[model samples]
Target: MSADQRKSPTEPQRGNRPPAHGRRRILITGASSGLGAQLARIWADDGRDLALCARRLPELERLRDELLDRHPHSVVHVYQLDVSDAEATERVVERAVVDLGGLDRVVAGAGIGMGARVGSGHADVNRRVLTTNVIGTWNTAEAAIRHFWDRQDGHLVIISSMAALRGFGGAMAAYSTSKAAIATLGESLRSSLARRPITVSTIFPGNIDTAINAGNPDKKWSVPLEVGTAQLAAAIEAEPASAYVPRRPWAYVAPIMRVAPLSVVRRLVG
Candidate 1:
């Protein structure tokens, strides 16, 4: 089957779930740059309270100042944190929940990617990508889940990738698997929390023009950083279980992988 043949996330029907209010407190990880930074700006511009976290203190401080200057009435809290460390992740999240008086949304956006062969004796690169992309995301999501469980009203936006549409080849083994794990994690959470008021949306974006792709030869999938971020924010507002942003292109790609023969997939990956 081609990607277009697979199921897509449609608008939720017959429900009165309203979009999160502009004043809602939102927590975003990896907010130092790229998509996370864009999301932070988008939320801030909407007049929402924000808790931004990343490992870089200077960048976080500058972003905080920018947001505060732009939206004086909006509360912007900055935390310099490494989400890969579970303890630190917990501490920062605790402060965010308390300082913001409970989070209405959490964007688990802290992730890393690589273009190295797995098991090529590059232990450092493998560990860095896996830790930041998968484990870090897990830690952030777990913290958000706990907080949302308590409040019973919140949103979780987990960012996966289109590379995850199939096992990534061309020097992306670990990166692809990590994203695939993210997609599954979001799906599992969606199932587990079906009865709750919390909404979980898993976003699979195509090639976005971020630092992640900074040094690579330009590819056809590139979309500006803002485009992907805006699509994500819109997806959050739409509140579906899963979505392929820049839907026209990737919506066709996702389903095709599902029914394709294994050999064909391998060849495609090659």
Candidate 2:
């Protein structure tokens, strides 16, 4: 069967369970750049508390200052984190829970895509991509879900990609593989937590002008950071099982990507 034709896990309809309001405190990793930074800005503007973590201290500090200046009522905490470090991720998350009193939501957006092409004669580059994107995402998810289990309430948001819908070649090889792994992880969590209070949302975003794709040659249907992120924020608020942001184009394009001729897929995605 094609990727789009597979049956979803057995569970009630995702829409019937709307997220409970008052997700006042949130934790976001990879807050140093790209989509992570934009999500922080939107949440802070809502006057919600935030715990932003990333490897770049300066960027996190700058984001914290920007948020405080625009919304002084919002409380923003910054942390220096390398999500690939499992122990450090656990510690940072624990401290964040203490700092924020409790975390109502956690966005596992920490990842890297180094554009490592297949057969590049160097495995190290692809290794780094997998370690950071797959293992790093796992660290972040485990740390956050630990708290969620203890508190018996939380939201886990896994930021996947449209590339995950099918395998790819060239620069996207490892990155696509990593995303596919985490998408399954998110689906598994959703099934495991079906009876619990915790909610797991998997996001498949299509081409939102970020650093990850700034160097692509044929940039088709790409939106600016703000416009894309606004759609992402809305989807996150809805807390669906899975969604493709800028939903119309993606909702239509995704199915075609799965079933289209292989040559057509190469031209469209490449």
Candidate 3:
């Protein structure tokens, strides 16, 4: 018999099938705490396998143990990773894929926020924020996309902020620019992979009570961590092109924020 004739119709053709959605094997960066950790918990509760990475080993391990205790059937791998390190990011992503059997989704959730006003002579602080938020996100995305391309099925989730809608002056300038860059990166990747099965989703979250914004009095519209992360996980699973978390105000607010005058922005956000 010819090789073509020997093929079974029941067997799926290579690179033709879309990624499985429910109970997915997911890898998340910055999974030690905040939104990342919350996402891990939500997925774990649903009996999904998770590969969690963060610089804080103790926190990651603790989270893993908690997940395992609650859902003994779930598989959780913990890795001490700093997404800013390009080489380490690649290596950890590959390792996670191996450990998880395969990857259905990757969340580039690692980020840092530091106050840096223009001409404040705090170049180091500004640089750190940019490196962690921009370079780190790029490193994670690059590694994840390479694997997704090989598998021809994967979802990439990027965590951006509502601040990305426009340029913010003062201490928020660096953070706003970094988040804008991330959103653009996700959008560009989505366009580049338009023909493929790979999915790219950028999440624009409004204020959430994560450690990053802890003690910040300026966060007027903050939601609880649980509420924000739950909504975020739903969006990530849906595989939408883009989303605004805590959709009520932010979904309505994002459009106006985009076209609002600088004076209005300053009054509203400042």
Candidate 4:
């Protein structure tokens, strides 16, 4: 079967019905740049309606103008949102659903990648990472779930990381932990709503050449922004329960990390 033809764990039985087609209404967070922006573009190319939000309104507006220019028929709405604020997240989600008419899928993609070594006087960095990655994801998921449950059908796409596969030391510790928590959150929702039409997909992405990580000297095994986001968009359309983008190495690497020695894992991260 084609990649998009594959069914997710929470997808209804094959004979029951097929996946939805035509213009999809999608809401994406952290869409100012990086993977989030690319995903929006991919969907827009398919003439999909989108509600995009990020802390940066100008960036979102630029994206909106670009999308409108490219796909005139597509409806694109931009909102300024900081997913870390639970109340704001909920309000924005509700408004987006209204503005877009309805939401078929919601992508939790807003996240930060700050470095702070353990026991280093920089506990603030760790706290910020946790708040933005974990709590922010939860806030987005909570809002999406309530709306999806009411409609009895929707897809929730959580952007996790390959770092979630194993624990890391030093600066990566908190970030790794946050990714793991969100992955678990997606899985838990997937299990709970298995019998329902609501689908939850957790995506574990490897190093992608986004603006956030552009300066990192270690570009080892990293895919370009376009390639990574294209794969992500395909996976989201497929609605897989969980996936590793540019799956080649990471799909195989994830399991190895789970069983590898602590020293080996440390070296791998370093």
**In angstroms, how far off is 192's CA in candidate 4?**
1.4
RMSD of 3: 8.7
Q: Give per-residue lDDT, candidate 1, residue 75.
A: 67
Residue lDDT tens for model 3, 80-197 = 9989999999999998877777788999999987768979999889888899899999999999999999989899999999989999888888999999999999999999999999
- lDDT against the true structure, per candidate, is 0.79, 0.84, 0.85, 0.83
Q: For candidate 4, what's the RMSD? A: 8.1
Q: Write the per-residue lDDT of candidate 4 for residues 1-270, one digit (tens) a residue.
A: 222222112221222222246327789999999999999888877767778999999899889778766655456788899999999999999988777777889999999887689899999989999999999999999999999999988999999998898887777889889999999999899889989999899999988988756766754589999998898888777889999987877788778789999888666644
TM-scores, all candidates, are 0.86, 0.90, 0.90, 0.89
Please identify which of the two predictions, 1 or 4, would achieve the higher TM-score against the true structure.
4
lDDT of 1 by residue, 137-235 (tens): 999988999988987888998999877777765467888888999899999999999999988999998777888776666355677889878987887
- Model 2 lDDT per residue over 140-253, tens place: 889988999999999999999988888877888998898999999999999999999999999999889999989987767899999999999999999999999879688788
> Which sections of candidate 1 miss by over 4 Å?
1-23, 261-270
For candidate 4, what is the TM-score? 0.89
After superposition, which runs of candidate 2 have C-alpha atoms over 4 Å from their true positions? 1-21
Question: After superposition on all CA atoms, how large is the RMSD of candidate 2?
Answer: 10.8
All-Cα superposition RMSD per candidate: 10.4, 10.8, 8.7, 8.1
* Candidate 4 Cα errors over 4 Å, as ranges: 1-23
